[model samples]
Target: MNENRRWSTRENDRVLDEIAKRQQNLRKTIQLNRKEESDSVCLHDKLMSEI
Candidate 1:
């Protein structure tokens, strides 16, 4: 019984770690997309001002 409990705990830990990693990746992707959008807006404004 104790061994089974230990195995369960390890599996839970691994699942939690995987979830955390995916969350981190999603956050980074969102941040990157936001940055790209802001940069595009800035470029558009600059071009409009020149014209």
Candidate 2:
């Protein structure tokens, strides 16, 4: 019974770690996308002003 419990605990820890890593990656992706969008907007504005 104790061994089973230990195995379950390890599995739970691994699942939690994977979830955390995915969340971090998602956050980084969102940040990068936002930066790209903002840059595009700035470039658009600059082009309009030049015209």
Candidate 3:
């Protein structure tokens, strides 16, 4: 009974850790994508200016 309780707590912690990692990764991905989009827009604007 005590062992089962311990295992349940451990499982919960593991699940929470996984969720945090995923959230961090998602935030990073969004930032990178935004940066990439801005870069492309800048390039497009430069091309238009040149033309």
lDDT of each: 0.68, 0.68, 0.68
Worst 10 residues of 2 by lDDT: 39-48
- Residue ranges of candidate 2 with Cα displaced over 4 Å: 32-51
Model 3 has a clash total of: 0
**Least accurate 10 contiguous residues by lDDT in model 3:** 39-48
Model 3 TM-score on a 0 to 1 scale: 0.56
- Model 2 residue pairs with clashes: none
Task: Say what the RMSD of model 1 is.
Answer: 17.0
Choose 2 or 3, whichever is better by TM-score.
2
lDDT of 1 by residue, 1-51 (tens): 999999988987886676567556656666758776566557556754764
Error of 1 at 49 (Å): 52
Q: lDDT (0-100) at residue 4 of candidate 2? A: 100
C-alpha lDDT (0 to 100) for residue 46 of candidate 3: 72
**Model 3, span 21-42: residue lDDT tens:** 7656656667758776566557
